[model samples]
Target: MKNKKWFGLLFFAMFALLLAGCNFNSSEKSDDGTKKSGDEKDGEVAQVLNLSAPADVPTLDSTKAHDAIAFNVLNNVNEGLYRQDESNKSVPALAEKHEMNDDKTVHTFTIRDTTWSNGDPVTAADFEYAWKRVMKENGAYNYMIATAGVKNAEAIMNGEMDAEELGIKATGDNTLEVTLESPNPLFKTLLSFATFLPQNQKFVEEMGDQYALEAENILANGPFKLVSWTQEQGWEMEKNEDYWDTDNVKLEKVNVFVVKDPSSGANLYETGKIDRVKLTSALVDQYKDDKEFENVKDSGIVFLRFNHNNPVLKNVNVRKAINMAIDRNGLTDVILKDGSTPLYGVVAESFYFSPDDKDYRELNGDFNKGTPEEAQEYWEKALAELGQKEVEVSINIADSDEMKKVAEYLQAQLEDNLPGFKLEIKAVPFAQRLEIEKAVEYDLSLSTWGPDYSDPMTYLDMWVKGSSANRMDYHNPKLDALVVAARGETDLEKRYEMLLDIEKILLEEDAAVAPLYQRGSAVLLNEKVKGLVIHPSGADMSYKWAYIEE
Candidate 1:
């Protein structure tokens, strides 16, 4: 996990549609008298869809939400200017009509007539306020605004100008105009992203700090609204009858229960308490032959991030040695039996295709691959360079079952492959792990990144010196320059070539980060759950078009 010419909104939309939609149909059924749908409109088929989540919602605030779980929730509870259809293509939602200039520097949109769950009208001002607020606050993901090529966005982020000068405005009650510093082919794709989703400015101001903290505090303009949410327990959603496209929303309610452990989630599914569950390696083994077993591909990469500030890790050969030592093939084949695969480049496979119509991985073969012999050579050189025979390092990781197992495997691989290497694992809660990484106090950290939109820049730009996601204190001037050029380059081929060069520098030459594997999920979904679109990236899954076929 983890674009085109400056043609305009319609061109962008077409490109998005051509992208491989991640949806895959699967089969399962709960029929032993345990299947229950609380309420139904037809008195036959219940539209309520039950699911299991690896974690609870961290936050529902669209502007601030970062994790997949929270973004998934926000995606359902709110509508932005655009949304992904069942085909996982960008389509207009709140903004019914849109056009961009020939240079793709300016975009104008017509906000559709819609109301929030609280009965307030959804206005063009909502989008403006939300985006400006993001700049003014400069939160963790604020780089995204600048990434969209919004004019003066970086200046505003740097405090050189007010957020009001960030090149977006509500020109009329229903019209929004946005000016971009440069042409962005993926701009329309961002419209469907959670961060770009609009906010009711008046309501947010009224709630203050408590906004989006609970079900009652949040407002919905999409297919569903949060009916109730019990922290660490479960959350429930009901159809938003006030939604602009309510008729197309098939699911009346979606009940998601927090089940952190794969075994626990499987147990709930077996007991008929949940309809969908993800399988761990062991569960995948057991359920491989089951009718409900569906191994879905994911566009996320689990990688090891080296803190460049660390004296030991600062040695490029040491980073390369670490990269070479790990047996990613074995890790994915055995440790992650849910179809995860070894990833050699920063950008995961099946994620981004270039303007020339070649997959990023297909275009750039394995870049940083190394054998055990190579690892030993790099290790010896690193030791001589640092005047050290051995070093002890700790890897910070989230204590999820999958991550813990992977960490253990990595620990064994490093300690065995590189003689005198002492690796320590410090596994903590997911939230705590994030805080630790954000502080840049860890020597090494294992992290996973899902793409926001299908583009090489999504993965390449994170290591651009001062990006918020660059928590490893890693920066390469050459890589930074390439990223900037890639972002602003209007020539698609040149931009794509820059992406290739950036990946070469980051993954091969500098070894800025060690990519481990591309993650895949083995899920058991009830066959009756129709129209569920599991995207490769951006918010994980969508229930807007999902419904219980029972």
Candidate 2:
């Protein structure tokens, strides 16, 4: 409750701003004159695909990118050794073939001969450099916790040892070997993450800290090479002629624009300026009858995170009560009309490491369906323990139109469900919200999580001790112990059991965070656009296979 009063004041200030005016208009031009009829004319480049995202690119550095926008951009510019297909099966990308030792402690990969966009050979040393840099930099990346193969990675990251002592090594120019302290069943899946992506060591050193700050400093080893980036305008990528699998590549160019306003995004798509745009609630009804509307299950999940370090929210009963009070179904149905499904757990239902399993659902049962009576019971208990006659809670949220609706709904629900309790809502810009969350400046805040890798541990390990993403300061010794045990377990069944146990503790006892709903994206795409692949992880635009119809 330390910052509760300040949070309340900020909430009112934001609400006043919202009342002043909210307008979403499109400034992009229509592309009616550029439309073609059938197939691409000989020697002509394929169609120029225009795509828009709700958020701008957060960071170009793979190690620092923790959001969807940056991941989408990285997909066009970088490739991991392995790729996770739609079915969650691991397939080769930079690695043509691989073999594991008997004990599974060592993995040998046959690196495909590839060149960076700058024409430099992509060697095993690149991977070694990236792995060590992430551990040494100790930035915002959580790779060490997600990928358990690197020996002493945690200690090295915590300043206990030099990064050079890390276990990954290059056997030869084309061969690479990684030594893990113990067997990791999901090692291949973890490689799909950007944090594990290889970097050009020479380029990074030459550029110093500004290596990935712009399109010119970074080099691409993937299907597309970043050609240009216009801040707040858009980013463009062209096919890499030197890509190993260039024959299979489809699209020639991909243009991604930052269209935070849904109405404007829809307008841009309708006018043919953009190939695809995400739909908002206000426009969903309008586009429901349009044949071009396409909806897919989004892999992102939204939740409420409490600042456990705060004096008021530190109480277990208060957290549990708040979680019980939320009506997730209503939030999804009324507030977010973009086809999101209420989640009973943190992981998306479609997400998987192996083809047949959903890591989170198999472990933790669906999220708790909130009830007023249940919330009231917990609220009374919390009040008694705190010896307070009245309670007031403040929540911080993103200033997006959809998010504001959700926040207002929560404020009403909490006040009506729990007597003698008052609620305040603060809406700030997306970047500002992130800054405040990092500072731990609010009692409660709305946050989201998207898959960083294919494993359940990607979502579960965020709250592990001393993790940068653990903004809530939620510490559980048993949970921490299970996470460690699961990381080293080679047996699939045992590893799963450990993960399931951790999820059970989090949902049943710890209640460290509340699961809201799994997000779904609705896009408006021009009929001419083809070969577009939407991965749940939001990486891999797959534009190489796309061509414009003449």
Candidate 3:
């Protein structure tokens, strides 16, 4: 997926108006099996939206949710300080009002009087507790470093200080104050992210480790609340009556079923069992001309993460050789025919914004792209340096249908292009694959990252030596310095330049990770479904404003 900033103010205003009419009243079912507005009543199936998920929700814990499926669900069931409107712009959600200092180093938010599903008032302390929890080492939040600019956040995450010493404070029940070590233009947008969503401090303490593990244990302060989650079977979310904007929530219930098979999902959509389904490459061509067919662009990049600690992969020459050998064009155009584009840089296209209104990619063009001969030369040098005739390495990948196809193609490409490298593919389930990455148990893992926000720093800062997402264990003092300097640099042009240089060092000079392609999804949505907002990054889709015409 790729992140695109919201532009054209007139366009967004019109978009908001289009969704403003989405609110549905307590309607009655007509004799023709259709909804009709009438007197308010309970136990009525006036509206219910059905969708299919490729995988089950791995973890609903706000701090631990790293997958798209979990993020989508969280986006609906939780309310943060802010949220993305119909046009992908951050707007106030739980926080009624927010103020930033002139230098943009400090922020103060006034929380609204919103009640949780359990009838408890949501307070500013909830936000403080949630943010502090993520900064602690025991939290293991994957994207904690994204907000490391918060004063003492780095110290808290690195165990240099207690989480209590972190920069956020609850000045009052409704007031939250945050101090940043450096200016961050995207901090408000970061607040709209799932990881930044607040958790009730009292409820968390009561539940302890069992918090967010089951549907019943969780509480919601957003448009919807989880009614049931049956693991692999499915989950049901009903509209939250206690939501501050419950009147704007149209759907009475959103039923999401886990269907791993694309064909099964397509069948469900066709048979009127599901309202939306994503198409596989096999089905993309078949449905491309249909009116309901929609291909959504995302600010996500898929790549190969080389474990720098791995014996054979520890060689820079070997890493570069693997980078040069893979045919990204073939991988995207052939193996992935679902509109995914080849990517040469770790940061996906259209995700970075430049102050001078110039394209960052134009300033710093494509990173290392080498031919077969160049790959062979590096492989030979690597073999000689390591004093090994040939080395066997495993490539861990998700066992999803699309992932399996890509893994097989990569395996063939490496074996054929780099002669001395014996590539072995290990395909595992999506949840197990994340565990393998966390444990650093794979030599080379097929991985993908969607930005937590629309900033270049979101993509660039992950490889800074000690980041939890830096599974490769890549460490370069030069690369680290550039990223750190970029974060504190207030001048937008200079900060972008620093980011470009950082990408050069990681993608070209050191070959810290291999870039493959930027992701795109081909989906079939029932035309009756409206107000379904698609984003370039963060949550893949938002159903807050969604409603069915039927």
Candidate 4:
């Protein structure tokens, strides 16, 4: 498609790069939400940062990490060949230098002289071990390597080949090589994500089941080392002195408070306990005039994922009727009120542009156009075929303050528009919700996906029948074939045309996932909190260059 390597891009969207404030030595919030200062550590002031995570990371094992929180955590703790910079572009990280073959099928990286938190040498073998581990385990993010055009990756995933033959090797202690089936222009960008991060073989083997289970079990090669984790309350990280670029890391410690309630988070911010707080609709209005309010339109879409194993959801008409009954506009404007746009398709607006230089969403247009009358007609057909007058379904959503409101609105909309349809809303912690959804044990679940790389394929690839992230068990021969073709397609225009068809099938014809809204986070941020860059894709945020302006 494009000639640029994986580390380069022709476009970069809006990124939240903030700068301000004096450094704090080690700050903690007491029970009443006031700062507890540790200004002196070993006779010197230790620069500290205060932050927040809405939820705790389910797992730190890079292979099993699927959510933004986990990605954000792993991204801070682990080093890969590259890392995304302040402008949301890929740049060198662990690799001191790199080169790609003339044909673009083979890439090589020279590992920099770095050591893990435990003082073990970081080598190319670590990368090889980590990459193969994901393929062998068939974890959720293994699709990333396949989509990156790694040779034999698809074959291995299909059981046609072994992971050992997956075209990656440790040529030497410091030399790593990767062979791709085709020239994937975004391969470097793909490498920047946590899924591609290296894992220490010895440490992992020693820890066994306990690897990454707690802060002490994990090792850090990047700028931060997770030091403490209290799932509900919060987590903490310290500057990794072992990092190759440790001289540049500013903050001595980073604190992430887990406050699920939006108002509580805002309260924590107002009390000087946290640096940033994600605002709810009410909080957004209250703080709209405040100098701290920021509205960042993300390249992620929050949607209702349909479980295909559920009989009602399996019926195309039923799915179509359900989508039509929900008012996406009302959900975003009234319920969310966070500048989010009603999502009509699975792919978000800021992800990719076609060869004709048109955003995929702009080119594809809205697909959810069914009216109430049409929804009722489809519902009737679904009932007749299923031989049922009433259908009951449960929607599992994360226990976030905003979602609590949205769940009520969804129940009201579906019940009001579709006769005899019952919707039960269930709320759980974000980590638990992921576990339940993986079992395909619910009729539907509220989920969101941000692009791992800036490509339409990132959105389209997961819905394929056997994809690890395809917890829905969705299978369409036509859609499957289109995705397979698009993954390997080198012609930009042709791939664009195919993705257009794929999106239509997914959003309109099959109605696999009910589009909800493209998320826009309105937050209360301290202008003085500098260096932390918020990305539209991949990891949600990066703090490598973070420092207090003071």
Candidate 5:
């Protein structure tokens, strides 16, 4: 992940410069049967709409996906029973209706008649099988721990029961019932996650353990079907004419190209080759004057991760010192010229379960305001405690130009602020950086997290005990206990209290991670595009409701 503060600074700078002289003009009307600039034609169909992103989709398998790029792709091919809307509220997708028992432990779902691309009738059994596979001990699903409801789910995942006995059950062909050990307040939100999406049991059994191993084996039940994926070239999705709500789908095809370079993406958008492109700091200034450049708020948190297992980073004082040294505001103002906001807490700013609640913003205190004097004091204390004459650390970063700028800036800041401290920076490709992080081979790293669901737990629970994502091995028994308690507490007030306490402890006392900022996505879209919805969770591209102007 690039330094979000810097990314924000760069974006803001570009936005400020662009708005200075640009006219906020209304979209022009189109004629001659072609779509008008920013206006949709009355009866035209977009044969293909091209889109671009910084990162390539890491995996097509929803169970194994842990990154935003993968989620963007898998969301098109698979969908859960429920989905989060623009307001971050849960809404029905595959399920027609649902009810909760008195105790709220049992959930009965009435699924709509939907079929997979392979022509298999989707049923309750499919959900059951998919849930069980994820809760299995060796399941590849990244958020499988959230599957606390399946029969013997916790026990089976913990190696105590047979994996086949997990809690999901198919009462009938179209009816499904799930029994959780306790009431899960975020149950509906969890259903919106990719891990809970139903899969074809027969298909998985026939393919063995490698089901959905490639484009050929996968099945889609969403609005679009995967037409083809040519690796590095691009992936194509055609609107599923067989979709249950096909009448609402307007785009005939969605063509996505894996453009890693932001400059090239901006150029493509300018030339009208692609319908949308993501603008980075490098290209923000050049296109800020264009009406096509639209600023989008993304619920993403960029931060620095310390390898707690590393001998050098294992020192709490050292971590705290580093956190106090960086100028977060400067990074946000200088590096990111977009609408990025500096973040003080683990959760991103304005992120909350309730749309009306402003508690997260109010509770977020300044933890990383760049106090060089305080950082120097802590550095001296850390050096003395370690019995070392000097302190040195290397930060492993991604190979993107934005990341390189961030790493260099941090190196200068840390080295200049604290005497006898040396900062070394290493830039590596994303894949290589992940391998190094997995091996606990780096002292510090740059990373970001986009929510898997619309819950605070989605951001906080990754640090819980036995979590695969807790690569740093940050052991906070009290924090772990609080997270576990919050999971079972259905009362909204109590859960909020628990989360606030956890955040305070993690941000103020432990300094587990240094949060940089919350980012805004700059997506340049053609005037012809209409009904494009941007969800806060950054989950699916809801092109079903989207239509190209005719």
Candidate 6:
């Protein structure tokens, strides 16, 4: 689960980072696919738009979705209680307005009269049904247990309490009330997230196991609906005319292609086949001078996750040696070529965890960045303890151009820095990589996590013992205690401090996962496309407010 927190990032295998060009300011594409000078709104509203995506969406079911591909599509096709506006503010969406009780433990929402793409009226019961469904025992939704702040949610998911007893009710057709176990400051903002989005009860039941498997099986109430989904190839979305805000939606159709090749995506953009394409590091130098080039800042971390169950990786000295041996500076500055910074800890600098505006990373200080001498010391000690003069480790990564380069870089770094070490690289498709990680079938897996929300806990909580996202099999009861303490603490200052300590234990002591770099993308976009939501957290991108000009 990239998002165990409301602002969670994705973690899987292979080219895990959404490494591409950054956010765009302005530029336009001519008919021949070349760049042209143009204003924000150069012509009349265009009915069709084309874009390139890195991969195909694995699932469309909001409850089961855990990747950027699925979430990006869901962001446009499903309306939540609130939606993140272009400025990243939580603005009213399905719920016209909401009010919190005195203690902030209970909230009442006044939902607007809306209709799904299939013309069924959206109702409060739909949201209630959706929430309960995800809370069912072993429902496998990434964020269900993470949302235990909702009263009885944990108990229901644990099967100790019935889903019907969860603290959510439809006081009226247009009225929805939710009671929380405690006051969560991020609850409203969490509503804007895809995992918390509404689903149609009647429609879901009708489709049963087939729900959201394809275009025809899904129901949408957002600005657009999934009209066609071709697995691996691409998908198409059309504006939902039944949407309450149809008048504001400019593009009638959105054509998205799953272009896994960076060079292919770049060519598509140059030829006017796609309005936006993520740039690979190999092509960043070529496009860096282009006016349309965008170096968008990302709020995520890329790391090397060790499967602790592996006999070799289970050794603390071995894990520490691997973590220190890598040259993160070289990777970020030279290999990535984007603005990504080397991370010494799991938490990114973008997060301000304390009330005094102190960054969590700074608080934890730097961990071991291995010099040749230091790495040798740890490696020798590790081998001596394991009774082996040499070792071989396998790494699993996504089969993208950028990630392939990353795996190669690591292979070179580790083999050169640590003696008696041989490395094997496995490059597989993005979806297959995720399956391998979930099954804990690899020795070393390159992973990335985007903050599910703005809080530092989003980054820190992933490593806690027994967490759904903690596929590493790494556990420290001491670190787990800090996480639990932070969650239950009402005082902001104390909570933030606890989080800082937790990160220290994870990176400095246990080396549960080796820090790689903060995730960011260098992207190219047509200036004619306006109002695309490029957020720092949550879903990587959203097109709900986007429109194209002629």
Pick the TM-score winner. Answer: 1
Per-residue alpha-carbon lDDT of candidate 3 for residues 1-550, written as tens digits (9 for 90 to 100): 1233344445434433432333312223446743332233484434767777777888788877778888988999999998988888888998898998988878899999998888889999988888878766345453454454788877666668888888889999999998999887667777788878888888888998888878988999999999888777578889998999888989788877777878767755765566778887888888899888877666889999998899889898998898888898898887777778888888777656678776666667777688989999999999999999888999999888888888888889888998867888898888889889988989999998988777877788888877877877889999888887887787877878898899888887888888888898888877667787888878988878888774
Assess every candidate by TM-score: 0.92, 0.88, 0.90, 0.91, 0.88, 0.90
Local accuracy of candidate 1 as per-residue lDDT tens digits, 1-550: 0023344445534422322121111122436644443334466766777786777677788777778888889889888998888787878888889998888899999999889888888998999999988877776678888888899987887778998898999999899999999888878887788888889888999999999988899999989998888786678888999998889888777877766777666765764557788888978878899887888778888999998899999999998898989989899888889989899987889868988689999888886688988999999999999999889999999988999999999999999999989999999888778889889989999998988876778888888877778999888888877786777888888888998999898877888888899889898877677888888767788888887775
Better of 3 and 4 by lDDT: 4
Worst 10 residues of 4 by lDDT: 11-20
What lDDT score is found at residue 127 in candidate 6?
84
Candidate with more favorable, higher TM-score: 4 or 6: 4
Whole-model lDDT per candidate: 0.83, 0.74, 0.80, 0.83, 0.71, 0.78
Clashes of 3: 6
Decoy 4 TM-score against native? 0.91
lDDT string for model 2 (189-280, tens) is 77776777888898989988887877797899888898877666667788888989888776667766666677666655655556777777
What does candidate 4's lDDT look like per residue over 71-182, in tens digits? Answer: 9988888889999888989899998989998998998999999999999999999999999999998888998998888999999999999999988999999999999999
TM-score of predicted model 3? 0.90
Clash count, candidate 1:
4
Candidate that beats the other on TM-score, 5 or 6, i.e. the better one: 6
Q: Using lDDT, rank the candidates from best to worst.
A: 4, 1, 3, 6, 2, 5
**Model 6 lDDT on a 0 to 1 scale:** 0.78
Off by over 4 Å in 2: 1-45, 85-88, 144-146, 350-363, 538-540
State in Å the error of residue 188, model 4. Answer: 1.1
Clash counts for all predictions: 4, 16, 6, 5, 28, 26
Model 4 Cα shift for residue 362 (angstroms): 0.7
TM-score of 2: 0.88
